[model samples]
Target: MTPYDAPLPQAPAAPALIDGFGRQVTYLRVSVTDRCDLRCVYCMAEHMTFLPKREVLTLEELDRIASAFVTLGVRKLRITGGEPLVRKGVMGLFENLSRHLRSGALDELTLTTNGTRLAEFAADLARLGVRRVNVSLDTLKPDLFRQLTRGGDLAKVIAGIDAAQGAGLSVKINAVALKDDNAAELPDLIAWAHGRGLEATLIEAMPLGEIEYDRTDQFLSLKAVRSHLESFWTLTETDHRTGGPARYVRVEETGGRLGFITPLTHNFCEACNRVRLTCTGTLHSCLGRDDASDLRAVIRAGADDAALKNAIRRAVDAKPKGHDFQIARAAAPAVSRHMSTTGG
Candidate 1:
């Protein structure tokens, strides 16, 4: 283990993080690395150039940044990545962050992964105070799953899900709705997830980065998808919130909860109370907009806790009201950076 494996010193307390739009920033999604085993068509290209190892933040730095947010009244933390599990010694990060949960400073600590390595780490995650996990699985069909993830093994992801549940961690399925790909299979997939007593969330494709495939052709609106599902089943609106962008609904037929993340058709920015921190220590106040602040420089320069807290507050204060996402026949992505880089 690295020197960062040990618990960090307590950060000095700061005022609550409230954005310019009067939204209290309570949730923080930190990307530990921008590397993933799968090459999802919507997320990134098949052959991608990853960041150099030297440019990424150290595990200890990640702990310090996260602790700074906690000191500023952030209650929920979500570890993300191109795939967070792929980062070596990441469990140590989680273990260190669990101290907040034990001290009642953090209400929840979780991660979003592609589930390729979940089977190997689920037990440890549950022990590290991770009560829930979000697994990105586009399809249940083995061949289609392999196609969507570009050589991802469906069986392995399924095994990971089983292991996560076996380890007593609540599992949620996050499937990106694609027009020509898994759109038709969404209902069946929701049913399958419900049958296993797991929540399923469908997300509309966001035009984040340039890919070989046309996003317009791949874009599937959640509005239309919901209309189709309502024809088959009764979806009653529910007042359930997980401190994320998803809007929840209770499926009467399946007796389970389903969520929709519609960045294109609908905007959840008015109630946006979260920010994303990339692996390189760039803090993005708004996911749709590219306004960012560099916290890595502050910490790496040997700046004290007060400087780090000020840097975080500046980012939060500059948060935009909402994102401008649009999809057309021949238009560039709203944001040039990949969703992986932004901690999807």
Candidate 2:
């Protein structure tokens, strides 16, 4: 067995992570790296400073921490980043984590990426037991895409999506609905994804961190986007859920599913079962709240599995019932940290 998969000593069964509000924390989103190949206007600043290599947790440490959560009943783990694929040797982490899937300790292992490198790693990711991926694509227009991403190529992302589908991995197109940018393209984008038998999810622009531009001008409510879509397509609500915040609906015209994540217009914190782990080993119990627990220090302190698990449980215990995310003129973000640092 790999070092990460070495069996742990037998101990009493650890209780599942249930927050104070009675929400079970079954999902964990881990950011492997804070670096990205593209700078989406909504996600990061054009000029960004990333964490140093030593400050970030090693792959072995990430595995141990993730394994502890799995032992505590985290069923799904999503490896995220500014771009997870850009991190060197990331596939090795996937391989190590797949052991959980093999042993039935984990139900799913996946990621959310910019799709800039999916063409190069899709097959390997599929082979490592990743069944699906969420590709963040804001716009399809070549010029507009580059302008929004500050140099991202739309063709490369589309090619990567094709390659991922070719490798038998289900693709979910996650587009951030911006009023001044991709709002008009929502119908076309959803149709394009549905046309390909892919799922399309639109997210309202969240006020996460400081960017070069203001978010108030860009914030487009998914509630309005849904009303607009209903004018053309037949949208019927479905009871489908993917263990994340997005609520799904079946589009009758395209015969595909559509999802909406309205963190601003709609508060979805009532059933929050997920926690975020940054690359530096910080545990954020709530994405919209600034409170955090330093898991990196705990790991580096040479804590045993039991101790690590206790730290995680303590973090979960303090998880807020909901986040207070708001966007307004000349107002700072509700959370100062970038979504990348918090595992988008």
Error of 2 at 248 (Å): 0.7
lDDT of 1 by residue, 201-294 (tens): 9999998988888889888989999999999899999999999999999999999999999988988899999999999999998888878899
Per-residue C-alpha lDDT of model 2 across residues 1-344, encoded as one tens digit per residue: 79889898777877889999999999999999999998888999989999999999999999999999999999999999979999999999999999999999999999999998999999999999999999998878999999988898999999999999999999999999999988899899999999999999999999998888889888899999999999988999999999999999999999999999999999999999999999999999999999899999998998988899999999999999999798889988999999988888
Q: Estimate each model's TM-score.
A: 0.96, 0.96
Q: When superposed on Cα atoms, how far off is each prediction in RMSD?
A: 5.3, 3.9
Residue runs of model 1 more than 4 Å from their true location after superposition = 1-13
Residue 341 in candidate 2, Cα distance off native in Å = 1.3
* Each prediction's whole-model lDDT (CA): 0.93, 0.94
TM-score of 2: 0.96
Q: Compared to the true structure, candidate 1 yields what TM-score?
A: 0.96
